[model samples]
Target: MKAQLIEGGSFQDSRGSISFVNDFCFKDIVRFYILENSEENKIRAWQGHKLDCKNFYCLVGSFRVSYVKIDNWDKPSKALKVESVILRASKSQILSIPAGYANAIESLEANSKLISFSTLPLDEVKDDDVRYNKDMWLLQ
Candidate 1:
């Protein structure tokens, strides 16, 4: 499956505002984690799961999420296409990345925080986790 952006919206009332992604379903999510970068342009690169999927949401500031479909688990091709999307807290949306892909994320603003929802439980992650060099596939 390919990457998809599940768009969401916000509602502002006299008291405050509410942001939501009404179409997002948590049925398959087994775990979740938050990613915060200390500085802008800092990247967390090239981590993948062969059997697990991931969903990302920006909680604070903005981010650039880059991903690539893996051609081979052992050694992916250097020419693999890289796709990216920018997520901002102002825009309530979720970036869904399906299994069999590698992804990297970069903070576009200082102290940006991103939440990641995973389909695999912590105990089963080790077996499915895969990592590659940061420079393996250049981001466009």
Candidate 2:
């Protein structure tokens, strides 16, 4: 199991690596992940948000993830450098993101499938989740 510190902090993910928090029961909080592994296992990058902390796990494929933290709302930029990690489906690996972090994912293979878990139910919002092309940078 490989782990890294979240940007701007020294805290480390020392607990179970492939685990999800079972808090805030998810009867409908959009436990889904966007797919982009269409051609040559290429997935366009995109920005996504979660109502609560989220867990991303690949059940049957491989992919890369770049995690970012937008701390400045005024200037509004990504904190630190983009941390990239490869997630594979053959292994039970889960990436956990606390609420309020901007993150992007790309599929390394065409058959890549990612399963994301959220603390909020799926039906709690009129627009539960928004998808932006990986190229669209100036997202607030």
Candidates' TM-scores?
A: 0.97, 0.60
On residues 88-119, what C-alpha lDDT tens digit does candidate 1 reach at each position?
A: 99999999999999999999988889999999
Report the backbone clash tally of model 2. Answer: 7
lDDT of 2 by residue, 1-140 (tens): 12232211122366624433333345644666645466753654545454556667776679787665545433444333456667776655567666555567777776777777676665663343445446546322
Best-matching candidate per lDDT = 1
Error of 1 at 139 (Å): 1.4
Model 1 regions lying over 4 Å from their true place: none
Where is the poorest 10-residue window by lDDT in model 2?
1-10
- Model 1: which residue pairs collide? none
Root-mean-square deviation of candidate 1: 1.1
Locate the minimum summed-lDDT window of 10 residues in model 1. 37-46
lDDT of 2 at 48: 46
| Model 2 score (lDDT) | 0.56
